[model samples]
Target: MSKPISMSRRKWAAAWAVLCAAGLALTAALDASSARDQQPEKSVSAECDKYIADIETQLAKAKQEGTEDGVVALAGVHAGPENDDCSDAFRDRFGGDE
Candidate 1:
């Protein structure tokens, strides 16, 4: 007859299986996150487009009103990190005129 597994060996086997499953799960999650990070900058959301449009409208109004201060303030906002994608979208839409 085949020898039965001892208690210690059974415990070791269960622990090894658990570790392997955990490792696989962690690897899959990391891969998915990296895949999202690799997406192109041009894949901005609708919200980003709307934000850029709002900035454009405000800038046009500032220019029309001859408010240099308003234009400078808006420029700072447009240069912020959160607006990077929106600004890229705006530039692409406007044929890089800005």
Candidate 2:
């Protein structure tokens, strides 16, 4: 049979349990706070989607034309006012000049 745990050992075990519980609580609180602090993700707009499609078309045409300069220019196209609302989306999809 296993010997009964000593009083000092019981105290130490209790202290360790409390410390672990406190650490878990602290981690949970930090995770919750960080989630609240983060900005919400933006959804891509229809205008931006259309803008991207146009860019893709241009890129395809540039490839067909076999003009390296035209292809490069289209590759680095920036988002304009027509689709400014989804500038971030454009940047993510095609990378922006900025």
Candidate 3:
């Protein structure tokens, strides 16, 4: 037969169990909070379309001006380090300089 658990031992065991359950709940809550925070941007196509339109407008204005600055302007946008929503589509339509 097993030895009977003392009163103090039973109380300690119950406290330990409560602490473990609380820790697990805290971990799960933090995980869910992070997942919610990291939700992806929606309507990617709409954002990309607007970006492309702006780029094309700039390109058209440059073309109409008929100046050397037109080439510089186009090159500046093409060679930009930052990539926006339309970057891939723009790259596919017009080859990347690098």
Candidate that beats the other on lDDT, 2 or 3, i.e. the better one: 2
Q: Which residue pairs in candidate 2 collide?
A: none
Clashes of each: 0, 0, 0
Kindly report which residue stretches of model 1 are placed more than 4 angstroms away from their true locations once superposed: 1-7, 41-98
Q: Write the per-residue lDDT of candidate 2 for residues 1-98, one digit (tens) a residue.
A: 99996678889999999999999999999999999999887766775677678877777787788863564333434557655657777578768552
Q: Which ten residues in a row are the worst by lDDT in model 1?
A: 68-77
Error of 2 at 38 (Å): 0.9
Clashing pairs in 3: none
- The C-alpha local distance difference test score for the whole of candidate 3 amounts to 0.66
RMSD of each: 12.2, 8.1, 12.9
lDDT of each: 0.73, 0.73, 0.66
Residue 92 lDDT, candidate 2, scale 0-100: 80
- Using all chains and alpha carbons, the TM-scores for the candidates as numbered come to 0.35, 0.49, 0.40
Top candidate by TM-score: 2
